[model samples]
Target: MRQVDRHPGKAEIPAGELWLVVDSGVKKWACLSCPGGCGVQISLSLNPEHRPRWKVEQDFWRRPTISPSIHQQKMCRCHFWIRKGQIEWCKI
Candidate 1:
């Protein structure tokens, strides 16, 4: 799992995976790779509300077509971005 700068407490929950966290309602809840361009969705369940806290639809990946960064050079499809921690899917 990797922690993103924007969301210091939140980490990439991994593709096709789900994670649950209990928040104190002071901080924001979000899915790491969703809005950034990854074709993944994240749903959160909060105590007063049972709605999706963050959701990234698969179609989001088709539009805007964000390119990989220089750090991802020569990496395979399975490789992806993780700002805070190492990626289990990709190892150098």
Candidate 2:
């Protein structure tokens, strides 16, 4: 995952790279393309006040691990976990 001052454009984020939107030194959003190969854009909230907020942690290698699995309820309906910058798809 990479930190960006603002939200990145759709094409700006390369495969397997997540953009962590940090404005004023505060993490605000986590954006990435759907790992389900559905060509969907996923933006998860990092705000504590918001429902379904996700927390991000980084290892010494700068690999990111997000708490709670990402579950897409729309088109793809893909469910997965990101641990150590790797995608672990749920068996459903």
Candidate 3:
């Protein structure tokens, strides 16, 4: 997904777009839609001091790679990984 440097809105973002919220030059959050097609918004914390935080790396092409995996406890409950701007679904 394309990483955008901005705050996440209360509404749903466009497909294939991820928001990287930066506050005062510090990366704070990563927001995106559920790749499972559930249309749920997922916000990940980027702060190192947070309990549940994910590391976001972008290649020179602007493709995003998120460390570990994303598991939605509610809604679709889809677990997946974002690597090189592609979604890799985890086996159930």
Among these predicted structures, which one has the highest TM-score?
2
Q: Mind giving the per-residue lDDT tens digits that candidate 3 earns over 19-55?
A: 8888777888889888778888899999999979999
- Model 1: colliding residue pairs: none
Relative to the true structure, how large is the alpha-carbon lDDT of every model? Answer: 0.33, 0.89, 0.85
Worst 10 residues of 3 by lDDT: 1-10
**Per-residue accuracy of model 2 over 1-92 as CA lDDT, tens digit each:** 78889877665466788999999999999998888877788889999999989999999999999878999877789999999999999899
Q: If candidate 2 were superposed on the true structure by all CA atoms, what would the RMSD be? A: 1.3
How does model 3 score by TM-score?
0.89
List per-candidate RMSD values in Å. 13.2, 1.3, 1.7
Poorly placed runs, candidate 2 (over 4 Å): 9-12
Give candidate 2's whole-model lDDT: 0.89
Query: By TM-score, highest first, what's the ranking?
Result: 2, 3, 1
How do the predictions measure up, each by TM-score?
Answer: 0.24, 0.91, 0.89
Using TM-score as the yardstick, the better of models 1 and 3 is 3
Off by more than 4 A, model 1: 1-8, 23-45, 49-92
CA error at residue 77 for candidate 3, angstroms: 0.5
